[model samples]
Target: MKLRYWLAALPFIGIYSGGTLAASTTFLFGLPFLLVWNLIWMAATAAILAIIYCLDTRDEAAHAGAGKGVEK
Candidate 1:
């Protein structure tokens, strides 16, 4: 139900679409369209996961005082 869950699903959707994307024989920067799709998805997956990780770390970041030295 969270935003990250929806974002995670996006990359999987791209995976399933590989077959349909492969139908295109277009070459991109000397690489096939399918290869380009896979490369883009790879970066997308990392970015999506990084977002999830940042979301997950919010609680840890909120407890900022716990790891700090006593100021008093």
Candidate 2:
């Protein structure tokens, strides 16, 4: 949707895909542990994204209010 959302999501996607690829390859050699690690990463990523979204929305609303005030 928004560029901000896409930017925020890019890191998580990269981490998940990279982790999956690494786990699938012979570099890590651990499957179950890597899977669990990726799951934890996913959870952390979600939390970070939620926080970012909240902050961004707050900023955007403040900017919109400023613009409205300027128009008066």
Candidate 3:
């Protein structure tokens, strides 16, 4: 797996840490802390996926260009 894939897995790391946070009664941004945490991680996952998609698209384009000169 690529480093980017490991980076993408980072959002899930927050889940294990969430048990400690569940004891808190505080609200985040007017929402429940756990809700906010999940939302934040969800957004992060989307952003990471978008970045991976863009990089893969770029790599594919580069590969396709390099293959254009082949006669067979």
TM-scores of the candidates in the order shown: 0.71, 0.42, 0.63
List candidate 2 segments past 4 Å from native. 1-31, 58-72
lDDT of 1: 0.85
Best by lDDT: 1
Compose the digit string of candidate 2's lDDT tens values, residues 1-72: 866677687666756666555545552335455565676677877877777777577777788788765643
Q: Which is better, 1 or 3, measured by TM-score?
A: 1
Q: TM-score for candidate 2, please give it.
A: 0.42
Minimal lDDT window, size 10, model 2: 22-31
lDDT of 1 by residue, 1-72 (tens): 988789889999987798696885788889888888899999999999898887786688768967697676
**Residue pairs in candidate 1 whose N, alpha carbon or C atoms collide under 3 angstroms:** none
Q: Candidate 1: TM-score?
A: 0.71
- lDDT score, residue 4, model 2? 68
For model 3, how does the per-residue alpha-carbon lDDT over 40-62 read when each residue is reduced to its tens digit?
87887788788867766667788
Each candidate's number of clashing pairs is 0, 0, 0
Q: What TM-score does candidate 3 reach?
A: 0.63
Report how far residue 52 has shifted in candidate 3, in Å: 1.4
lDDT of each: 0.85, 0.66, 0.77
Off by over 4 Å in 1: 57-72
Off by over 4 Å in 3: 57-72
Worst 10 residues of 3 by lDDT: 10-19
Clash tally for model 2: 0
